[model samples]
Target: MRLSVVDTELCVGCQCCMFACARRSGLGGIASSAITVRSMGGMEKGFKVIVCRACDDPPCARACPTGALTPKPGGGVRLNASKCIGCGRCAQACVLGAVQWDDDVNKPSICIQCGYCVSFCPHGVLAMEDK
Candidate 1:
């Protein structure tokens, strides 16, 4: 599947994606959501959409000593928290800054491509396309 961003100009800087990403654990919590979008300088200029681009070669997966990060069937990274050692190396390895830190849990929050956040997005900015 291809991760597509359409009509990004319509984004409201609401950070609904961030909160949705945090809701992937199916518990309506931000403890495990992995995406984040924030303002570049100010909200007036628009928001910066930050999410895993389903990289062909993901550095975060490579940096995980415990192999917690793995390749998803569609083309994104899947995080196995049980295997993770709470190391921040994967977060540092992600160039897109898609990997978020769970301050409360002291672990990396990686996207699972569940599209839960996409459903919560009020604006039609994020979409999952079968490429």
Candidate 2:
């Protein structure tokens, strides 16, 4: 399954999805979340929900020098933390900027397409769908 943005217009910038994503990793803050919510400028301009698009051939995976990231079956990538060198290349390679950084561990916190954040979207702005 892949997480999708169902409707950006519905987003209120509450960042509940971000919080839920972080919670799934047993973290207490948005710093670890794979998903992000940002204002366009102000509340009236709506919000942008940033998350992995599950690219078929992800550039981030291609940029992993240590073979730490491998492509998932459907889309996106699976990160092997043990092999990661924390080079930050994956984050830079991702055009969507979906590869989030974890300053504490110095590793990328990528979405596993687990859909944990979907349920927390009060505005129905997110969804999980089969590939």
Candidate 3:
């Protein structure tokens, strides 16, 4: 699949992408989204959109000791919390900084390629395409 994002130079530095990404968890709050946008300085320089690049060979999956970060046959990695050991190896292995650490739950927060966050983005910053 060809995954891409719609980067607009006209971003308003509003962290709607962050809140949108957090909404992908199906929770009422914004804790599960993989994307985040933060102010550069005082919102004058604008915000930075941070999210997973959906790598071809995800290094995070290789660092999981419990097989919690297994790659799906279709694409992307499938995180199994039951098999997770809470080790930060996956986080360290991820060069793109996509694998996040959930300190509250003591687990790694990984993106499963679910496109829920794309809908919440008013700026159209994220998308999942089929190759």
Evaluated against the true structure, the overall lDDT of model 1 is 0.78
Runs of candidate 3 exceeding 4 Å displacement: 1-3
lDDT of each: 0.78, 0.91, 0.69
Measured by lDDT, the strongest candidate is 2
The ten-residue window of minimal lDDT in model 1 covers: 23-32
| Per-residue accuracy of model 1 over 1-131 as CA lDDT, tens digit each | 65567766888988777777765655665666677777878888887787777877788888989988887765778888789889899989988888889887888877666676778789888998775
- Segments of candidate 1 deviating more than 4 angstroms: 26-29
Lowest-sum lDDT 10-residue window in model 2? 24-33
CA RMSD of each candidate after superposition: 1.9, 1.1, 2.4
What is the C-alpha lDDT profile of model 2 across 1-131, one tens digit per residue? 88999899998888998899889868688778888888888879998788998999999999999999999887899999999999999999998889999888999998999898999999899999877
lDDT of 2 at 116: 87
The better candidate by TM-score, 1 or 2, is 2
